[model samples]
Target: MNRDNEKRVTPNLDENELMNLMVDGIRKDGFKNPIETTPAEQPENKKPVIREQNRTERISPTEYEEIFFKEVKSTARHGKSAYIDPVHHKKLTRIVQVIGDDNITIYAYLYNLLEHHFREFEELIKEIYEEKHKPLF
Candidate 1:
């Protein structure tokens, strides 16, 4: 035998041996990775380092309130109208019953609304085209 092949050899570790070695190291370290821990120091609240007036004009509380309330009212009215549309409300009720409370029903209703709008658009287009270019009748 050649000297290269005749030397005593150590057995290679199998998967289980490698896994056991890792588990043993982890157990000896109390199951936590060795990491440095440093306590955070509290930041001092000092005066502004650089004082500068805001370039943007700030709205007064009254103006802010008026704008906020107007937006809230407008959104509430729109939401009520959408929720109370008889056709949409009925379809939504049926969909909820069938689908068991899945929120995707809202998307389904939106898709149906879009489809209805598209049909209306097609009708309007047909009407306009017919008026502009009457059939050769």
Candidate 2:
């Protein structure tokens, strides 16, 4: 065969030709037909697993009594006011009596009250001790 007279077979491929060749290679490599999936069929709406928060458990009657008496004893020892206010001690005592043996409720109530009072005290102290400076104009 004369080299110049023989028809030349050019194997250079375009992008689409290259892609078809790749697909053919993949089919030959045992991925003959990929399974078709629809957007709705896919798990797009799946929610991630999350843990639930632990709830606070109720306190026992003995614990409640212990806490109540301890507060009383500590107040007496510190010579602190027996109530949230001096004149309102009896009314406060009645309220405490009404809430007796309910440690969880008592604790929550006390925590809220203390938080409010502490914030008020902090504001008072800030106002009392706050620095005042005159502008040197």
Cα RMSD (angstroms) for every candidate in the order listed: 24.5, 28.7
Model 1's alpha-carbon lDDT is: 0.52
For model 1, state the Cα shift of residue 78 in Å. Answer: 12
Where's the lowest-lDDT run of ten residues in candidate 2? 68-77
Q: Candidate 1, residues 28-105: lDDT per residue as tens digits? A: 465344464333432455222454456337767565333322211122324433446889678767764554345334
Q: TM-score of every model?
A: 0.23, 0.26
| Clash pairs (backbone) in predicted model 2 | none
Q: RMSD of model 1, in Å?
A: 24.5
Top model by TM-score, which number?
A: 2
Candidate 1: segments with Cα more than 4 A from true spot: 1-83, 86-88, 99-103, 116-137
For all candidates in order, the CA lDDT equals: 0.52, 0.52
